[model samples]
Target: MALSTDHFSPSPDAAHLRARLSQAGLRATRQRLVILESLLTLPGHPTAEQVHRQVVRQEPSISLGTVYKALDSFVAAGLTRRVAAAEGTSRRYDADCTEHHHLFCTDTQEIIDYCDPQLDTLIREFFAAKGLQNFQPHSFSLHITGSKLANK
Candidate 1:
């Protein structure tokens, strides 16, 4: 199904999205496309509810349950990543599947991406030094929690 691009600020590339879904061995459905597009276009990490809200604005026929299912599918297909909150709050979804860390603000409940080569190398080296018995390291990302300082 062709999705209306009115709701999206920066319209997503439909062909690229379809190709990604195909590469991931997932079927490109209208609901999945809308959900993925919402995730890609929205700024910062958004919750499923936020995605649902954005999707329904353009595709009112889509249900919230469908949105939830699409999000799960996206996560399973490696098209998106779920970021768990430290306080056991609702989880947020990120479209960037690249290796990077997050800077979470406890005060504002904001999550910001942080990339540092030194930190990544240090963590990997430390883990390599203290090898696990049966576990194999795939990738690691750090989530530092603190409040963001106000602008002067």
Candidate 2:
């Protein structure tokens, strides 16, 4: 599906990516492109290891370290967001640069995207009223725990 555009039509993902690379003044290397394309295609958030595995399928010569470097570049370029799962097992990369939250399932290790305007407004208001200083709140994702409790 083609995305609709407004007057302030932000560049398409590919164009934005090229522009980011140019702005960052980094050469558009194949490894970077492959790793980036993989990240863009992958849905939800993914661990560095997961991203490496996926990239390897397409570019066998790419290494895990290279994947990490590419991810760092993307984060630096503001093309992707890095989210640390509450479990701390692995960090997940989010390509969707939109306002949303996450619902994590302990049993299945699932991360679900959540969008609630009421919650967003409340959080913003709460933080604003507190007069937080020297704070750079880039994004917010609520990690709620859920699982079946056993009757001991």
Candidate 3:
């Protein structure tokens, strides 16, 4: 059966991307728009090379170096943040700016977003009760690393 286009809402257009960039304190240049669109459409967290590959398909003139540069700018503007990958691997990027933790599967080297209100509460309480001397914590992520089990 042929699928209808109605159900599939269109991806964020240039105007929306421009607004997002403006809100994030970034200039919405052509390259930045393409790069931002790639980042939003990609699933889970992706590395710089992966993002570059996606963007290049849409705009061949955009170089991997440009993607790297744009990603660094995004990081500086808080539009995106780097997620720690497996030891010795390239750094992964996450567009989600919310405060949350991650579950890293060592076997597959996948990063899964983990959210637990109880855990958040416990950590805040613990820190509130016993804070580091002369050190104030701003944000943190407790990445749990383990192998993903196979399901029967």
Candidate 4:
């Protein structure tokens, strides 16, 4: 499940990114923009260190601490999410903010996006039937853990 670097599509232009950041109440600072660009361009989920490495290529003076801070800001601003890897693995970041599930491969520790309308409906129906008091459902996502089969 080691993804090729080229697997990811290119990110949006700087203007769109700046608008997103601004809408989230975050300033589009150079460090934050560079870090976000790196995250968005990376295939598969990458850890903060990996993001820092990529950002370093563009902004050699950026510090690891700065990257971490920017990631935190991104998460807070709903620009990205912090995904938990398998046990004993470093946390990874995902820039996709859409409603989607995750397929986590235990053997390779790789996470892939999964989308299922039926599953979404089933979950929502089941929960709605419960009719819990003082509880409201905002969203839901499933994390299926298994190994990926090798390609022929």
Q: Which candidate has the highest lDDT of all?
A: 4
Candidate lDDT values, in order: 0.82, 0.73, 0.83, 0.85
Give TM-scores for every candidate, taking all chains together and pairing residue i with residue i. 0.89, 0.75, 0.89, 0.90
- In model 1, the runs with Cα more than 4 Å from the true position are 1-9
Candidate 3 per-residue lDDT over residues 79-103, each given as its tens digit: 9998888654788888878888878
Better of 2 and 4 by lDDT: 4
Model 3, position 58, has a per-residue lDDT of 84
Worst 10 residues of 3 by lDDT: 1-10
Quote model 1's TM-score: 0.89
* Model 1 lDDT per residue over 1-152, tens place: 12122133586699988998899889999878888888888878888899999999889999989988888888998999999764547878988898888888788787788877888899899988999889989998788888888999
lDDT of 2 by residue, 55-132 (tens): 899899999999998888888877788886757788888776677776676876766667788888888888889888
Write down the worst ten-residue block by lDDT for model 1.
1-10
The candidate with the higher TM-score, 2 or 4, is 4
Pairs that collide, model 3? none
Cα miss at 72, model 2 (Å)?
A: 1.3
Residue 2's lDDT in candidate 1:
20
